[model samples]
Target: MKDRVLDLVFLVGVLFKGLDGLAELVTGVLLLFVTPAKLHQAAGAATAGERAEDPHDLIANLIVHGVAHLQHGSIVFAALYLLVHGVVKLAIVIALLIGSRGIYPWAMGALGAFLIFQVYELVTNPSIAVAILTVFDAIIIWLTWREWRRGRELRTTWRGTVAWVFRRRVAT
Candidate 1:
């Protein structure tokens, strides 16, 4: 029973990690196309007319708009990420409490690293936040790979309900 509970917790963590990875991939792809100027406008920054007199006004205007849009999108994304992150954290914590535990150290280390990244971003340049997010994306990808490997191993070793459902779908 305890093992079953741990398996469920692990599955939830894997799902959340996969979702996070996909979100990061989508965001990165979007960034490749959406210019800073358009982001700034989306964020409610000043229009081009507001700062037309300065020689570098065009660049500044673009930055302002881009930053604004980035900030706005960041807020929404951050909130959703935090909620899922908290749930994953809680699942791990609970699993540890139940003694299905060897992952406490890793969990703590990952949380600490993320917290430090956030603090550093808050104190320094906002642009640095993008780099921190990229690091997280890498972490999520790694987690996703590990989870997928575990799931694959389980499929070959056990005739679980999940495998049964997947097999049925594939047959149809």
Candidate 2:
């Protein structure tokens, strides 16, 4: 029952991250072709008036602010960063879903590192989205660690069983 629950939780994480990666990838590509002025204008228009009271108004404000002073170099850097982050996260999601034992540590490390950065970002910029992402990353790191420990135990048990069988056969 615990295993099932863990598997379900892990699967949810994978799916969530996979979708996030896809969104980031798409956004990255879009950033390449859209001018900052156009982006700011569109975002401003979308967030104008009554929309300011919406829950996601902060996100819209952030986007408008970001593109308001955008540079070409910054656009390229942001695009590259989003693309790499999306690709790496998607790969991790696939590996975790497939139960790749070797990937557990790497996943934990990557998520842990990202969590640390998110924490810093939260402190410096203090966005609700960043806070949510930090929590999610922390959860993933814990899950990966637990899964890795489980894998280690299973491997040990399998080795012991194999060794016992071999000894029994030799004595027979």
Highest TM-score, which number?
2
lDDT of 1 by residue, 90-112 (tens): 55445444544345446545656
lDDT of 2 by residue, 1-172 (tens): 4554565565567678889988888888888887777777877887676365774676677667777898878888888878877887888877765656898788788778778878988999898889989988788778668768877432343345456557767999
TM-score for candidate 1, residues paired by index: 0.35
Q: Give the Å error, residue 80, model 1.
A: 21
Best candidate, lDDT: 2
Task: Kindly report which residue stretches of model 2 are placed more than 4 angstroms away from their true locations once superposed.
Answer: 1-3, 48-63, 152-172
TM-score of each: 0.35, 0.72
Against the reference, the lDDT scores of all candidates come to 0.53, 0.74
How well does candidate 2 match the true structure in TM-score terms?
0.72
Candidate 1 — worst ten consecutive residues by lDDT sum? Answer: 152-161
